[model samples]
Target: MPYEPLPDLATLSLAEIAALNDARKLPPVAQWNPQTSGDSLMTIRADGRWFHDGGEIRRPAMIRAFAGLLRREGDGRYWLVTPVEKQSIKVEDAAFIATDVAAQDGALAFKLNTDEIIVAGPDHPLVARGTAELPAIYLAVRNGCEARINRSTWLQLVELADADLTAASQGVRFALVPA
Candidate 1:
């Protein structure tokens, strides 16, 4: 049998994506420490564990936050299965997929799917080069603060202060209320 294509979240209108989030059918927001620092550039505790830079929710709490939306199979593993790409990825293991990586502000962002994982190299167009840490940013709108993640530091989280994290991803952003 031929393989079917998954649904692309980016293709949907903002309103449509909002509807999906409203219906609780989308992935839960990842958690980050809001109190750590407000710099866009920061270091993440890549000891194979997620930490909150300073936001409301922290690591373990983040797991609960992502529970249903993104399931944890076993150990400290979580998967994001997207219909559009018909692919699932292990959140912690940043090795399996050869993602196109990029460093913006302080966030080490990856763009991956079934086809490829693009790791943003030094030569990548979006690599942020500087010694001063970027400001710590969060996703905020008329409603309130949404999700938060730390910036990147060679191999750590950069300490950013008073920065806006609205451009974390291309996907529509949403505020996750703890249950």
Candidate 2:
């Protein structure tokens, strides 16, 4: 007898296979945030997972007031992934020191020249360090001071970088920063 080929999965009707696929890849229902517009953000209740615009996932982490940056994908979508860990500090905190770059000896140093922050923690003295031009928020603990990076600010930075880099490098910048 001749071997038989399997049926094409794509050929199946939507109603016929929707239930089976949903069961296998079923994510928990999410609690929608009224503050966010459009279908960009989703909060899954099953595991407290947060899905951002560009399929970026965030867990239960304390996001800070002024850390990270946001970038837009070509498909009219935005991604919020921070280079540093998801903790941020207010710009006006007493412990916060704005400097050019972060150093091990410096508890909290902000690189005004580069627009970055360097922070230290108890367990790890050089806990977090990153530039202020990314699309995510961060939090750092240093000198008994807790710092937070704002998500909104991060998003704005991402948008700005995208435009400037695009024009200057003529698409070379896109290679440097991933979508």
Q: Which numbered prediction scores highest in lDDT against the true structure? A: 1
**lDDT string, candidate 2, 55-148, tens digits:** 5343222222121222222343332333332222112222222222222221322222112233223331322233434422233332233223
Encode model 1's per-residue lDDT on 1-179: one tens digit a residue: 33333235334444443444465433432331122222222122223233334332244434433333343333544333232321122333321221233444333343222221122223221223222343322222111111222333222222221233222334223111111
lDDT of 1 at 146: 17
Alpha-carbon runs more than 4 Å astray in model 1: 1-8, 25-133, 140-146, 149-179
lDDT of 2: 0.28
Give each model's whole-structure lDDT: 0.30, 0.28
Worst 10 residues of 2 by lDDT: 167-176
Q: How far is each candidate from the true structure, as Cα RMSD in Å?
A: 16.1, 21.0
Q: What's the TM-score of every candidate structure?
A: 0.23, 0.17
Give the local distance difference test score of model 1.
0.30
